[model samples]
Target: MTETQIWALVFVALTFSVYIYIAWRSRVRETRGFFVAEQNVPAIANGAAVAADWMSAASFISMAGLIAFLGSDGSVYLMGWTGGYVLLALLLAPYLRKWGKFTVPEFVGDRFSETVRSVAAVVAIIVSFTYVVGQMAGGGIVFSRFLEIPQAGGVAIAAAVIFTYAVFGGMKGITWTQVAQYTVMIVAYLIPAWAVAHTITGIPVPQVSFGRILEELNALQAEFGLDQYTQAFTARPQLDVFLVTMALMIGTAGLPHVIIRFYTTKSVRGSRWSALWALVFIALLYTTAPAVGAFTKFNLLQGVQGQPVDALPQWVQNWQATGLVSVSESADTITSITNKATVFADGGADLLVNNDILVLASPEIAGLPAPIVGLVAAGGLAAAMSTAAGLLLVISSSVSHDLYFRYVDHHASEARRLGVSRIAMGLAVLVAIYFGINPPAFVAQVVAFAFGLAASTFFPLLVLGVFWKRTNAAGAVSGMLAGLAFTGSYMIHTLEVFGTSAHEYVFGISPEGIGTLGAVVNLVVTIVVSLATRPPSHEVQEMVEQIRYPAEREEVGAN
Candidate 1:
């Protein structure tokens, strides 16, 4: 085995060891310990945990890749994801903690009705399931490249590791696991960026130090005629880009996995603090990613735009072996010359470049040595695996705690409830693996779909259900169902037709841009339905009031 191979194995072992250690320490026998970390998590620590868990495989791998390849348009993810959580802090976090349920669907059931709760529960599963597969795919990619495992084998191993930590550690395990993951992923992402930026522009953190990068990049663009995506929006002078950002921002606040993090803190103050900390953690990686991406893109053009095909770099050869990169082959002399060419004349140089390699390739592009590149592979895996575990915990709890305990056995013993939760968690991991192996042809594209779906379906439901008491069960149900149906159908159309690339489908309404419109549909349906139906019972109104202000009442407690 190669030295880089050994380093990769050592890195994985070190990360897994920490998770095993935390799991042993944080293991809980009761349902409370398993699902909610006993609600004793400190604010800053929980924020760090939330940030670690929420910034998954896609963020680590694709965020920079998108920025580098797509140029400024990639900023949409940076703004949408980070800005969305601001809404989570301002609007959702405190109230949910006060309502104090073990799971999000539990709160939905309580606020609206059993029906609304069940519907929300199902929707949560869809969003989480679709997104988790992306994480699993990332894990497989990491193992396939770094550890030399077959892609299928690597994915299964990831499933097994996620199962071990998530099922046994529960939220408690996932929380601390994420703490470790955050460390591995952020360090992995930032160090190379620091080195590259310093070498190129004499800055460590690229986001704050954009002054130099901007100057260098503009010089390159001016000399080379580099067409950037962000320039398109700026040149056109329109609000289409603005609307897409709003959809991502609103949708992020509504993601179930992210919201559940707030519930771990001990107090409302803790909740707010956690959001701030999480932002700091997220920003550390976020700021550097775009600069890394842009630099990588700039370098790629300079190196390959007119290079001979047979002279492709060794790194490209390694990437092709992993199937992450694909190319069309030809032998005609001029066509051979055309085949050798990297960048195309009109635009879009290489369709062969995987959207997932930006982070992994940053070290090499900057001419960093072998060991640092190996470290990046490990970091990518940490991002993917840590997120898979957190997602599994939620899916498991949805089944074992919320569905089984709430509906199947209202009087089941605590041990019995915990047992069922474990079983459900086991089953969910298997299903996630299944999806990973036979992932729908559009797995990558589904990342946008998950964000769009979450923003559309759940954000509105959670907001009105908590803050607006007059939103009767009928309205709540209608709003959620309408969002789910409209978005689901649109998503099916998106997947069936578009695969992954963005297009001007029906007046520039791309899948990523549809959530706001979906939320609007949900809101309209909810209002119309609420007016059409009887007001919620006085008891339900009282429940909404209780959730709106959780910090005040220590009276009833978690019965």
Candidate 2:
């Protein structure tokens, strides 16, 4: 095997072995343990696990790429996701933790009616499945590029590994494994970024050097007659950027897998603390992403623009083998004895570099050592696998715990429930694998769709359910259905799915941003319908008050 491949194999084996060991050590048998890690995880460890779970392949592998391609517009993801986490911690996490349910659907069931619970459960499943497909696609990318395997083969292998640890170890195992993953991915991400920053600008700190790099990149882009590197709204409309940012922010607050992390903590305060810790850890990478994006883009332009096809860098040739990148001779291929002005613009057109490969190829592009390249490959896999495990667990719990056990057999034994969860997880893996092999969009884009769905369908219900006591079953159900229908239909219409051509976006909102409008629609419908219908039962109202203020439960009981 090649040096990069060998190093990658070694790193991958070591990391996978560590994950399996953690899963084995932390395996659970009971339902509580499976669903919420027995609610005994310490705040710091749970924080790390939460970070690992939240920063999936999209964050680790694709976010920088998005930034690289979209320029300043990509700041929306960084801002929306970070801001959304704040919203979740302040607005939802503490209250959800106080509610102390095994799953989101369980909270809905207790707060509303059985019918609403079922609907929430189905919605949770759909959102989780949609999210998992992105993770699988990302993992597939890492495997395909590093392991020299086909994307489909890579996806199947990732599915089997996820099934092994996630199904057998459940939430308990997934939490500990995620902690390790966070460590791996962060270290892997920072090392290359630091090296590249130092190499380019003599500053090892990416956050500091990226500013200098951006100036250089803008000059280079201008010379090539391309849009400036710091330009915004060039790739997407201004309205879409705002709506997409809002959708991602609210959606982060609403994702089932992320919300469920709070339930794994010992107390509501633990959940809050964990959220704070997760933000700190996540910020480490988010802060560095722009630096990495600028550095990689500058490197690509400088290294490849005027290079001969036969004399291209080994890294470019290597990636080209994967068919994600391509270079072709243009009419001016033989007349390339020119300055930078004529290269990117007039001579041979630029190489078709896929954004998804930017981060993975950055180390190689910068001529970093093989070990760093392999470490990045391993880190990408960790990011993808860690999030995929969390998502799969969410799907399993929603289906088995919320739908089957709650609806099918109230008296089902723990063992039987666990069996059903494993089977559901296996089935979910199959579905994820299929979609992974045939993803509808890029990793970050597909994930954005998931966030949109979550924002529209669950954010309004959860917020209104906790903060507004008068939100009855009718209002909750109506709001969820309306929001989901609107968002789902918009996405289906705007996205080229199932061989259908995309229609014009409504009001200039792209599929990625439509969820914000859908959420608005949901909130309006929910308020109007709640006012029209009778308020919830006195008991349910009391329950809502208790969720909002735990001390009130004892006061109400005494009264």
Candidate 3:
């Protein structure tokens, strides 16, 4: 194969080997070990794992691409995602760690009732399933480009690998695998960014060096009769930005896969420390994303905006072969194009560029080396695969641990529980592959929907469950169902799948921003219903009070 393909295969194989080895080495026999890594993972390792899990394909493969095109509006994603971690650490992580539950549904079930627990389990399954779709699609994109395979082939290969580790390794194996993935992801992301930043701005610090590039990008946009790249509210409404940011922030706190990371830590202190370390690891990538976005935007405009269709760069041509990027004289038929409004204005250059391919193609667009491109391919896959494994575990635990063991067979043996969990994960992998092949939206957007759903369904429940002692089982159930139904239906009605027009949106809010409203709905319904109904039992109230504080007995025992 080609040099880039060879290098990509080499890095991918090496990383996959490491992941499989870790999974095999760390495989667990007991349910506790499978679910929470025996609650013995150190703070630093869990932190890196959390960072890797949270970043996902959306952060590594698609966030910068969104920023490249959406410009200043994309800052909402950066702010929302990072800010959500702060919320998680301060408001949720330590409390959950204090409770020391294996899954989020377990917390809900214990805090409320068995019925609420079952509902929460179903909600967790739905949210995790939706989230995995983006991961599969992201992995497919990376493999299709670098490995020179069809997207379907790429997705199947990734599914098999994810199954090998996630189904076999459980949470213990997934944890260590994610730590390795974090190293791969961060290095792959930063190295190319460092190289390009230094090459273009003569500065290696991409985060601080992108100001000059942003200015030039704005100037290029003005020349092309397009809106300035740094201009905000031009592509999206102001309210939508605020609402979407809120959804993403709370959504990050609410995501089950992310929350479960804190539960893996040894103590509440460890959980808090893990959050801090995760932010440190995450910031390394987040700070540099703007630079990568700016550099890619500048390069594409300067290098290919008006270039001949037949004479495009090899990277563009390569992507075009995957059917994601299209260049044609016809404006209506192209898949994606920057500034389509301006490009169509004067017998214009019809250069269609899918945002998903922008980051993967960034290195080649900047004329970086084949090895760097391959490294990036591996990084993107790492990001996708890491999150995919975490999501599968969530689904497995929700079904086998939360549903089957708790409800179907209350006395099921450890071996039976593990078997069911693996089977659930295997099924989840197959379903995720199907959705990956037929995705509802671009990677980031589909993930946005998941975040929105989580924010609406779980954020209010978890927050109220922890802080408000009077929150009864009835209220929690009503709030969760209301929030989920509202948010899910709104997304279905407004998203492209249902063909709803933007004009029909509720007060001009986009599907991505509706979760903020849904969260509010949940909070209101929960509070009102709780006030009207019987309060929680004295024991449940005491449990809430205890989880609110540190687990001193456990801490003393451990010490």
Candidate 4:
């Protein structure tokens, strides 16, 4: 094996060993332990788990790429994702923890009706499955690139690893495993970013070096006659960006994997504090993303601009061989002596830059050492694996606990439920692996669709159910179905999933932004239906009040 592959394997093996050790130590014996870590995880550890769960492969691998290509427009993901945690902390986390459920669907079922719970469980599965596909695909990319394996092989390995931990350790195991993952991923992300930032501006801190980097980037843009990197807006309409941001924030609040993390914490206060710490851990990477993007882009321009094709750096040739970067000869070429690759060329050997390469290839492009590059590869695996484990656990719990145990056989033994959960988790991992082997779109795009679905279907229901006691089962079910239908249909139409062209859109909103409109429809439909229909029973109203107050939680615990 090559030295790079050897180093990558060492890093991957060490990280995997740590995860397995944690999982082995935290093995569970009962259904509650499997589903919610027996509700005993400390605040700091739960915070790290939440961070690992929330910052998935998309955040690690694609967010910077999006910023690299979209320029200022990419701020939507940074602001939207981080801001959603604020909503989670203040609006959802403590209330859900106080409500005290093993799964998000359980909360819905208790608050509304069995029918609503089933629907929410199905929605949870769909959203988690969608999200897991991106994580699997991201793992595939990392493995395929660093381990010299096929993408399919990489995905299968990821699935196997996730299955081992999630099936055996359940929430208890995954929570501690995620703490380790968060540490690895954050370190991996910041090292190259800081190294590149210091190399460019002599500023060791990337977040604080934005002004200097931006100035250098704008100068490079001017030299190449390209659009200024510091421009406030680009060809993408500003309204569309705003709507996408809104959808992401709402979706983040509603994601089942994220919501379930709070259930693993010790108390409502732990859940609240965990959310705060998650935001801090997540912000470490989110804040550094733009700096990484800007510096990577600047490096690319500097390396390729006015340089002869044959004289280009080895990194360019290496990535070009992978088909991520390509060169095409100009139609009108000068004498052989003048023929060269130029960023400003109308028809020269213009570089067709794929944005996804920004993060994965950053170490190589910046001439960093092999060990740093291997750490990045390992970091990518941690990101994908951490999120995949969380997604798979949620899917497993929704099937075994919510659907099977709650609906099919309520009297099943704890051991039986645990067996079912492990089996369900394995099956879910297989399904995600299949999708990863044949993805429909880019990892980030697929993840965005998952977010849109979550925003449209779950966010409104959970929010209204907690805050508005009058939201009966009929209204909640109707709102969820309406939002899902509208959002799903619009996504299908806009994405041309059925091969139908989209000639018109409501206010020209893209599929990514349609969730906001669907959310509005959900709220209006729910309010109107609640008014027309009977209010919830007095007992249910009391439960809502109990959820709103921490002191009443003792009564709930007694149950």
Using lDDT as the measure, name the better of candidate 3 and candidate 4: 3
Tell me the tens digit of each residue's lDDT in model 2 across 236-267.
78998999899999999999999999999998
Residues 36-65, model 3: lDDT tens digits: 999999999999999999998999988898
Q: List per-candidate RMSD values in Å.
A: 4.0, 3.5, 3.0, 3.9
Residue 286 of model 4 has an lDDT of 95
TM-score of each: 0.91, 0.95, 0.95, 0.94
TM-score of 1: 0.91
**In angstroms, what RMSD does candidate 1 have relative to the true structure?**
4.0
Scored by lDDT, model 4 comes in at 0.86
User: Who wins the lDDT comparison?
Assistant: 3
Indicate whether candidate 1 or candidate 3 has the larger TM-score.
3
Candidate 4 wrongly placed segments (more than 4 Å): 329-349, 498-506, 552-559
Output the worst ten-in-a-row residue range by lDDT, candidate 4.
331-340
Model 2 pairs in collision = none
Residue 62 in candidate 3, Cα distance off native in Å: 1.0
Error of 3 at 162 (Å): 1.3
lDDT of each: 0.77, 0.87, 0.88, 0.86
Q: What is the alpha-carbon lDDT of model 3 when measured against the actual structure?
A: 0.88
